[model samples]
Target: MIMPQQSSKNSGLWQQATLLPIALVAIEILVINGGMILDMTTSGTSDATRVLLMDSPHWFLLTGLVLGASEILAYRFLVKRFAKRPVTELGATGCIKETALGILVGSVLVSLPMLILWARGFWRFNSFAINSGILKGIGIGLIACVFEELLMRGVFLRLLEQKWGAPGALVVTSLVFGAIHLSNPGVTWLGALTIGVEAGFLLGTAYLWKRRLWFPIGLHFGWNAMQAAFWGGNVSGTGKQSGLLDGTLHGPTWLTGGSVGIEGSLLTAVIGLLAAGVIWKLTPREAPEMAPHEAKTPTDEVPDTGETPAITASEPGRQTRRD
Candidate 1:
């Protein structure tokens, strides 16, 4: 069908603004349906019940990976065609560093909260084990981190910030992030709120600080991975799986997080805010004054002197122009 025409600026702006939510919904549908098909065909489930109850990790990984690729392709298309921007700034080296820092920051933020609970005698160690589930869990974490960050931080936050500025975007995205988890099996209002205040702002802030998805993705992956793989905790009310450590909670549901995991606890909020503050402070500040000092063009960088304006060992007393 033919579409209404719009100015170039408005067209680009709208495309940059709204494509993320569309992409999110599209990916979810594709992943869910694709997983169902794989499960039904491979698991010999001839009925709807089996499809709905599908839990095979193989199908999950296959669907997640395929859809993850699709999401990236979609992102590239939007960025190049509609947004009219280069994808080069998503530098490989920078992504790795940001992701690693995110993981480290997330690990510390999440662990500290749980550790506080443990210190208060709200948690206990019950058992310990490791299995193939850990790999599956990691795969799930990877997919979740990449996709969620792409949607929430990379796209949603960017658009929102453009329209509403940082504070508005931060709150909106954070609340949305928490709201999505409300459908989790045992999530309570308080739990969801805690998630909003803690993870929502924390991850969004991580993205805002670095202006890259990798950092938030790493933070997200590390947070879920630690909760699932390391602690064997129920993530967002999902039942716990085999992890490196099998543990138990022993205090009020509010303090220990009951089955919803430590993310539902009060301590998480405090630590999350602290981590966000640290990340905000650590981000490199832009040297705005350097902009005016830069050469107007490549040719303007040098003088007629035999030597370029660049300082060198041979010109000990000579000074280079600041620009």
Candidate 2:
């Protein structure tokens, strides 16, 4: 029923959609596995020594640094080669301020739910202490938050937006993000769904708000580090050996969020969605004018400002010359 040219066009479109994401993921996996192998080799043949090294906060910090640098280089290479755009998402300008704001927002969102649960007598703190666990938590959070934001927002969401527009891209990315966590220990269907909806929109809107990766990365790191290391709660479904504050929840799984931490709570969902809405409202409707000194590619008719174009429901497939 289809003409050869039309069928070929469809096939090309499909390949275009699938290729970059697949390649990026593959590169990431290879980097991670290679790092693991390197760590094992350096730690020597004894299982005990390897385990000890792996658990050390210093080691985690070292690994995070290595992995972070590697990922950034890989991301920059891919974006430059395939997307033919400047790597402005990882721009250093105002990064500290944006990241700090994100950390504050994330801490507040997590705190509100815990405060409510405590007020209602559903939760209680057992103890407070500071330990190396906090450092380890920071290391883990840095690596994870950076890696995920790069892969999800930097790569997947950006590419999808090019094809499906912002709204459709957000929805698709959110679902995929949630689905990816189904394999995490202790995650339920409900838990994964909550993550998809709350985190997806929250992170996506953060990118839309500033058109940079720092805010979302800081937000993610703050949430996970606070929940697991500071608050003494499970993260996703996995429990750490220790946290700064030892706490217990005595309530329904729905209210307590069970093993998935506060991320699974209804209160968190409500608050996260509210925050996302506020961010969406605050997002600029149009890209700001670029400074005259800003870098421009030879192929660009207009300077690439790295800002997301104004999204409209009616033009889901509209193409723009800028990133």
Candidate 3:
């Protein structure tokens, strides 16, 4: 794309502007997390503390992570501020509520068909009532929730929503989030769709409600820790995790999700729906819009990135200078 004078001027400024917070975050993660990794390895704790655990430190670690990731502060300083496009309480709140409700409804919608199939003797639901260790279970669930939510919900979703508007940003991010998880171990089409949309609902709710990374980060971390570590059920059907349960599931793939994990199971869809519904209840009837920033650019030359590129008279790519 071509550039305007102002955008050209701003590049040097914005480049550093953007990188500032990112650099700080990178440094912090590497330093703090790196130390944690080191401590675990050196003190013979690596097998346990290397990954997240359902324990006190894990909770603090997740919380510290968000504090370290407050790039929005950097955003305010670097970008020129702007305003909303005439937002309403319904648009924002409804979008959030509907996002959660839609997930809940959609999850149930998908699972119900499968449940009927199981009942009709075509298949069976395989989930077993098992008990993993308490601390161990919590740890596993927390890690899953925290890491996935932090990366997808906290990082990607926020950035997309910032530029693409809430609807476009949230949907695309959710899809991407689900697609990425497909790489795990036993990701099936059903599981991917179920968890992806379900994840979207949970994270989307946090985004709209808190407008901060901490809540989603903490919630994601906590849930996963509980699910995988506490119950010892294979998370998403990948494999036997070293969780509290330390056992294998039996029955039809649908019931137990055989190795593709629960995300692909009918029960997962049902659970996701119920969870989304609960989120909908918690969300407010009214919500606030994202704050605005300046718009700079020549109409014809704005970069394809959702952001509107702006420039100044003195910049190298200035229309006047280029022409």
lDDT of 3 by residue, 133-244 (tens): 4444454443344345444554455555555655576678767767777787778776677666766666666655655444554555444554455444456555655444
Q: What TM-score does candidate 1 get on C-alpha atoms?
A: 0.78
For model 1, the superposed segments whose C-alpha errors exceed 4 Å read 1-6, 39-54, 284-323
Model 1: per-residue Cα lDDT over 139-244, one tens digit each: 5666677778788877778767766877788899999999888898988888898888888988887877757677787899889877877877788788776678
How far off is model 2, as Cα RMSD?
A: 10.8
Q: Tell me the spans in candidate 2 whose CA falls farther than 4 Å from its real position.
A: 1-45, 287-323
Quick one: best TM-score, which candidate? 2
With a 3 Å backbone cut-off (N, CA, C), the pairs that clash in candidate 2 are none
* Candidate 1 lDDT score relative to the true structure: 0.73
Q: Could you tell me the TM-score of candidate 3?
A: 0.51
Error of 1 at 220 (Å): 0.3
TM-score of each: 0.78, 0.79, 0.51
Evaluate model 3: give its lDDT: 0.51
Better of 2 and 3 by TM-score: 2
Query: Residue 174 in model 2: shift from native, Å?
Result: 1.1
RMSD of 3: 11.7
